[model samples]
Target: MRFTLKQLEYFVAAGETGSIARASERIHVSQPSISTAIAQLEKELNVQLFLRHHAQGLSLTPSGRTLFQEAKRLLEQAGGLYAAASQMHEEVHGNLNLGCLTTLAPMILPELTLSFTSAFPKASVSPLIDHQERLLASLRRAEVDIAVTYDLRLSEDVTFQPLVELPVHALVGENHPLARESRTTLKELAALPLVFLDLPHSRDYFLSLFDMDGLTPNIAYRLTQPDVIRTMVANGFGYTLVNTAPRSNVALDGRTLTRVAIDGSHRPMTLGLATLTALRQTKLLEAFVSHAKSIISQGYIPGMMAP
Candidate 1:
């Protein structure tokens, strides 16, 4: 025998509110209608759903408790279905779970999130900050819909759309000698101690910059977090390389760090939006990607200049 979702919903609501009148008010149906629907649902399922007493409004039987759990799940799924249907309209109105590499998260996420929230007021966005490899794994597992990461050696299971070309810059403290240079070469900056982000992929990417110039920079400090590197640099401890300047105002004792140009003819890192090849593109995801691409393309003008 088949049972209707409406019946399960009525039963669950009645169980929750503990009164037919309250359930009717919550579900926007009459108390008699709610009572009849739950009674019919219990009879159809061959279970005693509610234990009714004169003073007490309602309580669930043992079988009723199990049915109530399943009913709640069914109601949640039904709500998701309704939301998906409603999102077919122009405005995006669903949950968007996106992941981003640590490097890009600080530089690019705030603007994208602001614009998305303004445009799709009904939609909710959840951002996951992780390293490149982990984000890629999440995309493969379908845990996240989209990721912003460097367009490196990606598997055939994923598709990458190049969104921005960000020139790598050298981050140095105000007192550091290199901070005063108009344009500096890697060979010149090689003498300074380098603090690495400690990620394999990022280390490879950073090392490749020096390798292209046929030189190796001195390594003194190794860390994974940008803030750690930033703090160290501010104290005149060491210098580090970054894809972009700090997006927000980063201050250390009322002094801001400086991002200087790096010379020696290195290629800009191609930051891309990646999605799974096997997954069907949802409208909300497509819209989000489109907006992101647009913002990245227009926001940062490409040219050779000091930061």
Candidate 2:
């Protein structure tokens, strides 16, 4: 009761983030500052709010869970008052912690600033580009406000809003044997050396495409980064599977890569926005989702297999 609004704000950030360090990074505050705030908050409330898990980061205690809801509601009320006073025709304005899949970051994130931030200039975006598992984990932990990523391995706690369907395509170098072909089958693609973009469920998803055709790809190399895989494929290293349809055939090093349409019964992955189902929707989040939907609808967002 004696704690200030700042304390509650910090507490909520810490609880949602599940890590004082990540909370500090996301909010642009020092770790020690949040630590001090948490201490003060606990002292004033006379209940332990977090359980320190050493290197694994913090987890909310039972008391913390109960208090988190109240803290969030109070913060929303306080924020509404602040926004009301600001006027300027109230629009979504706040620091939104955003997560983009590493592969999609190149295509989606760049447009985010132009489409979303340009409209809501008052909003500040803190973007975290990572893999699928990490993005979903961040959402569940409340580390990220919203995530723009593919629907991969989503748990019950997460909600996925599909923006566009980016189907699986074969990426090959200009000089590759299959490069000249306008379209090819998954079976034909499997025979070539595969520069597999190995990342958790993504690797398996690509393999599943081959399985659909009853053919297993000869995965010659396994790399983590999508750009790296593109570079390798562009340099004639091997063929690879990708959902992101790069607008240009150029790679980082100015190499020309070609995407050949598949002639098989392979399932395509959807690029969507993922968020925690339990979190109360905020104006900032709604604005971002709206902007994203518009981007996809308008064909502004890159990496779409042209319809």
Candidate 3:
């Protein structure tokens, strides 16, 4: 083989990211190194792998797409060989590409990832935080090996292992009229302004709670960032629905907030691990899965309030 695995790895990164600069950021290699590797690989392979677009970035050529698929397969096989060796030694090693829901990441990832790595010092985790749709897409594309997310609109190609149930809560400013209440109904909240967490599947799930009762919330603000939504709620902008309640009742701006359980039974989101159904679970992945199952349970979770 004229080209090395390092060159193939760089080529694959460029193909996936569609830009040498972005690829460099992804793989922690310098842009020049990635560029040189790609140039060397193309020279050895005797093919034009990418069509450069001025200021727009790179795109795979027809042959490049085919080779990209094979390159990804080869990388997976190489990872499998490493996994096999680790299994022989009965040790967990290598990097676990973990995807997490953006809303849950801050509360869950730090504790969860740190503990796992501490337990298995040889294994490290790289986290990608995003919304539901993108997380699922990442699983399909093998961009992430496992995703700690909600079981929301999961496709047939993905498998979800339920970890715990997180029921919906009405988040409000401490001084809000309903804040004193232990629990509230959707009907009562429908009349008031709502600070909506406007993400793909998350938006639908929150709205569905009202839809189930044939009601709609008077949406006052639609925000993407969870902290921003919490701060808005703390400032009495409006109440928002959240599944995972942080350990603290105070928002980032130092304003107090309240978490009131939604009255009656509603569809609680199931927090779980999601992965591609077709992908074989490596020994490292198995170890992480076991650790996750042990830590995340009904009565206890790492960063969030007890369920």
| Best candidate according to TM-score | 3
Tell me model 1's lDDT, rounded to 2 decimals. Answer: 0.81
lDDT for each residue of candidate 3 in 205-235, tens digit (9 for 90 to 100): 9999999999989999999999999999999
For residue 294, what is the lDDT in candidate 2? 78
TM-score of each: 0.67, 0.70, 0.72
Number of clashes found in candidate 1: 0
Weakest 10 consecutive residues of candidate 2 by summed lDDT: 298-307
Tens-digit lDDT string for candidate 2 (77-178): 999988888865556898999999998898778777566778998998999999998998899889999999888888888989998777777889999988
lDDT, ranked from best to worst: 3, 2, 1
lDDT of each: 0.81, 0.86, 0.94
Give me the runs in candidate 1 sitting further than 4 Å from their true place.
1-91, 247-249, 301-307
- Put down candidate 1 lDDT per residue, 34-148, tens digits, no spaces: 8889888977888899999776799999999998998999889999998987766656679898898886686677778878878878877899999888988999998999998
